[model samples]
Target: MGPNMLILASAAVLLLCGAANAARILALVPVASRSHHIWNSALTVGLAKKGHQIWALSPDNLEDNIYPNLTQMVIKGTYEKLREDFTMESFVEDSPFTFLKTMWAFGINVCRYESSTQAVKDLLKMPRDFFDLIITEVVFGECMFMFLHHFGGGTRIPVVGITAFGMGPWTDVLTGARTLPSVFAFPILPYVSKMSFTERLQNTLLTGYHWNNMIREYYPEQQKIAEEAYGEPLPPLIDLASNISVILVNNHYVLNGPQAQLPGIIDVGAMQCSPAQRLPKDISSFLNEAKIGAIYFSLGSNLMSELLPKDKLEVIVATFASLGPGIRVLWKFDPKVPIGHLPSNVLLKKWLPQEDVLGHPKTLAFVSHAGLLSTQEAIYHGVPIVAVPFFADQHTNARRLVELGVAVHVDFLTLTKESFKEKILNVTINPRYAENMRKMSNLLRDQPETPLDRAIFWVEFALRQGNDGMKALRSAGFDLAWYQYFLIDVLAAVLIAIVSPLLLIYVTMKTVMNKLRGNSKSKKKKL
Candidate 1:
């Protein structure tokens, strides 16, 4: 009845009404990988379910009916180049940097190919098209920036950066460009937090190589492709990249080792993670039959296990045979691989539901390639692993798992049957690996809301924030020079201050000593 109460009630009503409004979002996920598709689709689908209109450009074949209020536009290209597993194997012979260069070149190929497509060209050319927020998956996806500016109408639009793996060089540079440390940001490399002098030098050089050569040089090419595709003028790629308000990484600091991160780099790590579902009766029966527990082995769907060398494959099969009846090996074997003479304890299947296997109580360990999604699932299930990482970020992922005390690593090149068997036995027999994994799982699962919920909340929050965006969240250091961000000038000032005082004291002391000597000489003459 009172004026004060009535005013407060009106304010509450306004806030409630604002919260209830839905905004249209355009999510561009223009990559071709099953894992990447799954991650992107889940986020967009979740947003649509929250009553927001979503127009998604993706590589997956999920229909609009599968998701409410989602407009699916698929980008068709010969993405099959990714599966030339034999070529990837040859990359192992090259140095890390060279291998990465080859991969980046391939990514640019994908970008150019995708840009030429009719769907992307048409989507950008749509008349007076606009959206409240632009969500894009970024890695080698710099071209997506044009969507923000072309449709932004000469104003800022909030953009969300999503990556299937953790932050790459560009995202690191984009989010915390100025403050990202050169010595310890081993985003996709294998290194502990504490660096030796030599390691620090390598890390710094590696960081510079990725930042300067790979990111800066390679990013603009995508923009050029976008400009040609749009057949219209567009803003500078650098300015557009800087405008990104938030980066939703598919990683958690708990799983990935501790590293400095900007506030805008939100970790919605396992947003696509699902609870273990029921396995088929046969698979369940096989797992339960294992007296000493079963291990799930899969290198993920992108690469086939059959590509493995015959000698190396023989060694692995022999190792499995050595495990005997006590422990069982459920290998996700490609039937085409022709793995001969499997032991009585080993069961090979062309396809197996991985999450269900890991979640089962009888499953003791996972032999994995250390992909981001698979690692999240293992941690979520509280199962330790023997990581046999081959290429890409897998090596770093494995190293991180080792750092977390939940995994033992085996180098694929030098791996003998003896070494593989030892690692598997070591992880399973040791209580420490499983214990550390459970401790991490508690931290991972103990969050306020699920990863999916957090992702949805932040996305909608960005939509509501509008043009003002989270300008404060982005570091002002981006505007500053590298030396200024590093405080080199400040350090210089401090050094001068310290040296100036000491120099003054030394000069004064020397003057006083000379004067005392002169006084002593005069007194001697008088005597």
Candidate 2:
């Protein structure tokens, strides 16, 4: 009851509040793919290690359940199982057309799953008073954005958007940057590689238009729910750049090209906190004895190694053969290798400790599909890569790494023993690639705090800021229209309207004056 007592009690309360604010973080990751799950799981584990509470909402999985200080809400069923019924050959008879069909189908399937999942629906419909900071995977179909807009309810807990791949247009827009070309929207035609300046511009515009339309088609109910939840007008597109405070791309600046002008987007690059798991004892001993180092081959989780055509498989095998005895091959093949003459140094496993093998000093080069996680892992370990991109954003990731001077790209369809051999040799044998990779490795590792620490710090910061952060996020999505955003179209239309009427009136007056002059001349002649 005394004044001094009251003041002391109030100070204690304020100090406790500050402590709680600094320790809380909620990460919502609804990733369905195995590779995506692994990447997200690593982040969750890292954040947990930093003493932050993690609220993970993902489909049911082994890793999600096991993470410490983490609560997981799993959506049932595996995406791979669903794809077994939907075969690639059924969708695209030709090889060239297959990648596009696969990507589109994959996106659609993910969207459908998210939209229909009971857990997602229930979570969105619940009263929005849980979790401080929401970190959602950007490519969780369309629902990630929907949840951010709906459950987020325009309160600023600092929605941090995590991208498994590089910063695409949607991510860029969310992070307060100007729009860029959509790699997903562009046509999958081979000639796309040879497109001219005008053609590329046309493709870019068309891609944006298609994506804008696609978002509407995928989540019509999101806008209505968001408006109701937030009690304000929502942006037309569900995934607006401004809704996010931080855009954390799982790419290193060294491998990815120049940074886009978005201040909010940060390249954390693979965020490999744990070292590679140790290789099996037998494999390890083999690696140690191999003088020339080992070639690590993996098609990633999404692409089954058994699915490749016989010829394509042979090309890979033969390339390993040409590398000679000094180089050992560790291939992650799904099924046991078909009965054939196997190379003496080649080692095939149903599963191998990929990161561990890559981290090993003996890992000469990585033969990969250029998936974002794999690329990041290779880069993090300073190992050069020979990227044979299969589908999705793999091509773009490959291009980015090659541009970074640390990786060589070998076209999948046109691949041969010679090309594969040449690529592997160029990346592994050349000191330049290793040196460039080392430089990037240094940049990736140069952060003042570990990526885990920074990520944890931001998450807690967002939570502490709360509603103020949310309002800032919503305001970031503010845009008038195409006419307003660009203004050039409006200017051109106004100029055309004004000029057309003036030119028409002048022409009419001249015609009438000419006719009157002719009449007067005839009268004079008659006189």
Candidate 3:
């Protein structure tokens, strides 16, 4: 054959081989947040590129899928509901407990809505063995796994769980991973991995509350929804959830602090992050023109910066206005939320390519809400941060950034023009923040295999192994009760074994002493 024909023939053979092994996979991430969609879609699309048929169900379409093998279905109204239900005001005004309750309510509501969607209904009509594998978000969407059980037709198809952000203790139970509350603080709290005694106590209590609530209140509601949707009784969701073969969590020891993870639990954090792309002309020009440096501020996709309270917004604007004339500001704001004029040096866009902005040579500091994805992106690009954490894990993420010496955190509730400006200046001008961030970025990038490749390999591994084969990776702790897993029973037995002999010796000695005393008294009386 001619050289050209030979090359084409070889390429065709490779494509055919890939197609032969292609599996039908479903990606269900019902969370309405854009960040969640981004992480989940990254995996599904990557799988599609490998020639697998991927069907993704999410709240955001994440633009049209570029891969022809990937099909995306949007869960209608979920995003709209999120925007209406959670606003900037809610983020700012809600206390920690209030925020937890709000999340609980929101999670259950979304789960119900997701199960009722027409798209899901159609999916339900497919053949029992239509899919080879199922990948769904584990947090708050456990009910979605009912599809796995349904499609398995008495035997569940191999399933993988994905957590777009930090893995919660509740989700860790899926792989029987130990959650040391003392070492791993609860996500909502502002404590780092190394915590004080009081912090650990609080973390333990809050972690218990989350686990308890999920089992008692959350699971029952999710179970009801699943049963209602299936129109038949199903196994308990906790049981179904435990059947998850593997979970790809968007967390790494470098960013989230080191901890023990079960073999079944894989860390694929920053998989959604990539090398910066070339910035758009306008954004590139804006950053390049900065005589000193530029600050990129975003509240991420969930919170809208335009909804900042008038007084607070004024304080922020004044702080930005006070920056050196040479310094520039690129702020992401919603065009729909009209706002008063900003400083001349400040430029606002409805959307900005965040990774590119962070990657820009002139970019000095990132002013962010500290969402996990944004934090990961900043780490990927080696950018320092001024974190203004409003709610959720933002507090914890901001605290970790400070603990790592790569960011300064600002309390939104106590934000003042002076404090905000000082934080911005501290992060931008200080050499430590940038230096520390560079070190962290190196650590995150130094892994042997790219996170995306590692994730895809494990996914394909699970498919090849099947559910039965995947069980070898599951922790034996999965079958253990909480007390048993902690070895409370073992400890109790050991304690009893040691204490029983000691008690017996003490009692025998006492009895002998009493008898000796009695004998002495009787002899004295007889004499």
Candidate 4:
């Protein structure tokens, strides 16, 4: 063939190859939280960059999502519904049980709202195999798993689960991963894995709460909502949840310490973390000009710093002022909130570019609420922290950081200017915290491939393997009943075997002794 003809032929083959590899994915992030959206966006956008077509359904906007291959289908007003009902006060004051109940309720409502959306309805109208794979946030949004059945038709569309935090007890059940209370802490509880008896009791009870309350009570409720939304009865949500192909959890063993995970459970923590970018001109100048160093303060998205009680806010303001002229404080404060006077060392912006600020060499320490994303970012940047955890897994994250020697914990409920200042200074002024953080940062960065890349590869692998190949990775333990899984029947049989043989031998010996005694009595009577 001529050169021109040959080039055209090669280009045609390449196009065919590209067309064959491209996958259609539906990414569901029904949890109405910005942080969760960050984790989901990383996966979806990363996949899109790799030539996959992605339709991301989320309640919140995907951060910096501008890919042509990726589209965002908004779940309208889901977050507003959350904001209308919950506040920072409620989060801090809620006990574990109350928090679990409240979260389950929110999850049910989210399922109803998401399933009713035009985007979901349109997707449902498509053929069962329309999408090659479904990636979803399974933390507080297991109800979204109903789409697995709706789209599965006869054969299932593979699903990959993602969570914005470490794998907890619920993750264990869903993925058939093992989590001993002795080796792994319950994510919501403020105890470490190596706990005292009392702490283990609490952790075990919390674990049971997942089975009894979440699986039994919460899943049933979500199942009903899913059926109502679909306008038909569907397969059980728990079964669908267990059918996940792979789980990309947003935690690393370096942070949470190591634990047993099934083959399908993958650690893709810090997927959202990236190299530092240039900050705004004004912010860059402020940090670069700091005489000593700077500190970044944020309570994450869910817990707003502006929502802090007046007294606590006052304490924070005063503490920041007393940090001395050399050290600058970039407090992520809402501009709308009025403050009559301000300290010269303190700067307030409604939103600061969090990762960029933490990545700055001038950034010395962080004052954080210990949200997983923030904690991961701090770990990535080698910045020590003053963890002022308020609720949920914040307490556990804070405790882990302290155990790792990279942070000092301060109780938010009992926060005072003195205590806050002390905690901040303990991490900032001391060289030990910085050294430990540097070591952690190195460990987290020393990976073979980026976490996002690993996540994307597994997703595409699932697409290629389809449902059956993914099913092989699922833990067989999930198919067993509780009694079977624990081997209660086997244990009972072994116990009976040993006890019955011993009892028989004892009865035989006792009968022979009685016969001997009777013969002796008869001889004595004859004499």
TM-score against native, each model: 0.85, 0.78, 0.93, 0.91
Best by TM-score: 3
Better of 1 and 2 by lDDT: 1
Candidate 1 lDDT tens digits, 1-527: 89767755654454344446767788888866767777777898777666677888876667434444678877865366445322555554566677668767766777777787778877877654567778887676677667777767225457777888676666756765542444454555666566677767776777777767754668778778879877877777767767777888887778766657788888889887778999999889888999999888888866557777888889988998898898998889866666788798888888887888999999999999888888888999899999988777787778878987999998888989999999999999999999999998888898889888988888877776765767767877777766787899999999999999999999999999999999999999999
| Total clashes in model 2, counting residue pairs 3 or more apart in sequence or in different chains | 11
The residue pairs in collision within model 3 are none
Worst 10 residues of 4 by lDDT: 9-18
Candidate 3 lDDT tens digits, 34-77: 87777777788778767788888887886754455677777788
Residue-by-residue lDDT tens digits, candidate 4, 1-527 = 99767755654454455566888888877787777777778888777766678888787776555455677887787767767766755587788777777777777777777778887776677777678788877767777777778777215678888888668866876876557777677777888778999889888787777667876788888888788777888888877777786889887988888777788889999999998999999899888889999999998877788777888888888998999989999989897898647899888899888999999999999999898999999999999999988887888999989999999999888888898888888888899999999999999999999999999889988888888888788888877876677789999999999999999999999999999999999999999
Ranking by TM-score: 3, 4, 1, 2
Worst 10 residues of 2 by lDDT: 183-192
Per-prediction tally of clashes: 0, 11, 0, 0
- Using lDDT, give the best candidate's number: 3
Q: Candidate 2 lDDT, tens digit per residue, 10-93?
A: 544544554443344445565566777777777776665544566667764654243345556676664654665455323323
Candidate 2 TM-score to native: 0.78
Worst 10 residues of 1 by lDDT: 83-92
Q: What lDDT would each prediction earn against the true structure? A: 0.77, 0.65, 0.84, 0.82
Q: Model 4 off-target regions past 4 Å?
A: 1-20, 153-156, 502-527
Q: Residue 90's C-alpha lDDT in candidate 2?
A: 31
> What global local distance difference test value does model 3 have?
0.84
